[model samples]
Target: MLEFFNDTQTIHFIIIVGSMSLFFIGFYGIATQKNLVKILVSFDIMESALFLFFIGLHYKVGLVAPILDKHLKTFTNMVDPVPQAMILTTIVIGLAVLALGLSFGIEYYKLTGRNDISKMNELRD
Candidate 1:
């Protein structure tokens, strides 16, 4: 049992399960929440879950950064840089999107005095 718990496959499975759980929780929150801010938060939660999965998927045990140096000549156990770079880009874009969404939500609240999605009614005007 101790060996099983310490196995890399078991660890990977646990991380994958945890990430999936987070994604589902976020999905459920998005489906049930009426507040715009809560929905945005759910989206962020989902994004975080995706990041976790991506990072976990690319990670390798006993691996160093994929940087070229004089001492490290062989690329035998260097971590991939593509996923890390992609995640960084995604984080920047997600930040911009979240800012824009919050600003829109703020404007809507200012205009209508409410932030609930169900309460928004624009057709009657």
Candidate 2:
């Protein structure tokens, strides 16, 4: 089962399908989920999927961690570190955005005593 993905002929296809699946599932949740928190989580899932795809792209047969030390590393070599940095930044930003969104969600719940948007009829004319 897993051996097919290891084959060079199908690695790219596997990565594409897996990453697209993750993205599509996240997109579906964003489009269909009603709860504010659920939507935010879906966005996070999408972000994670992108990061996974990035790391998967540079993945080699036996790559070592890109640590700058005196040692010569290992049998293979290092991929790239830019994606790691970008993913770290993205995860932090995502946390900040999620926190802000949750704060707004809490405020809405407090003001209306409800979590569903359909029931939020206080501001409607």
Candidate 2 C-alpha lDDT tens digits along 1-125: 77765664477567778998999999999999888888888988898889888877766655677875677745347867888888889889888988899999999988878887656678679
Tens-place lDDT digits, model 1, residues 12-107: 898899999999999999999999999999999999999999988777656788887999898778778889999999999999999999999999
- Name the regions of candidate 1 deviating beyond 4 angstroms: 68-73
lDDT by candidate, in order shown:
0.90, 0.81
lDDT, candidate 2, equals: 0.81
RMSD of each: 1.9, 2.8
TM-score of each: 0.88, 0.81
